[model samples]
Target: MWDIIKEIITYSLFLWIFLVLSYSNSNQGRILGCNGKSECPQRHRNSTINA
Candidate 1:
C-alpha cells in the first residue's frame, strides 16, 4: 500500500515538473503565434503591434 502511494506520488511529481518546464519554455512562443519569430520589442503587450 505504501509502495503504491509512493509510486503515484513520484509519477505525479515527474509529470508536474515536465508540465511546468514545457509551459515555461513554450509560453513565449505561444504568445507570439508560435512561429518562433518573436523578438523582445514585440513581446510587450502594451506595444502598438502587440496590443
Candidate 2:
C-alpha cells in the first residue's frame, strides 16, 4: 500500500540521481581529455606518427 509507493519513489529518486551524476562525470571526462585513446586531442598532439 503506502509503504510500497514510498519504496518505489525512493528507488526512483536514487536511480535518477545516479544517472545524473554519471552523465555529468562523463561530460567532465570529455572536457578534461579523458575520453578514449583515439578521441583525445592532447594525446594526438603529443605523439608522433613516425611515418
Candidate 3:
C-alpha cells in the first residue's frame, strides 16, 4: 500500500514540474537569433572591425 501511494505521489510531482517548466518557456521568445548572430546586445556590438 505504501509503495503504491509513493508511486502516485512521485508521478504527480513529476507532472507538476513538467507543467511549470512548459508554461515558463512558452513566453520566452527566440533564444538564438537567425544568421548565427548573438542575441545579447553587448556581445553583438563588441565585435572588432579591422580597417
Most TM-score-accurate candidate = 1
lDDT of 2 by residue, 1-51 (tens): 999999999999999999999887665447776654645655555656531
- Shift in Å, residue 15, candidate 2: 0.2
* Candidate 1 lDDT tens digits, 1-51: 999999999999999999999888866656756453335534553554531
* Candidate 2 residue pairs in backbone clash: none
Ranking by TM-score: 1, 2, 3
Whole-model lDDT for model 1 versus the true structure? 0.70
Give the range where candidate 2 is weakest over 10 consecutive residues by summed lDDT: 42-51
Candidate 2 overall Cα lDDT vs. reference? 0.73
Kindly indicate the candidate among 1 and 3 with the higher TM-score: 1
Candidate 1 weakest lDDT stretch, 10 residues? 36-45
lDDT comparison, 2 vs 3, better candidate: 2
Off by over 4 Å in 2: 27-51
Which regions of candidate 3 deviate over 4 angstroms?
28-51
| Separate clash counts for every candidate | 0, 0, 0
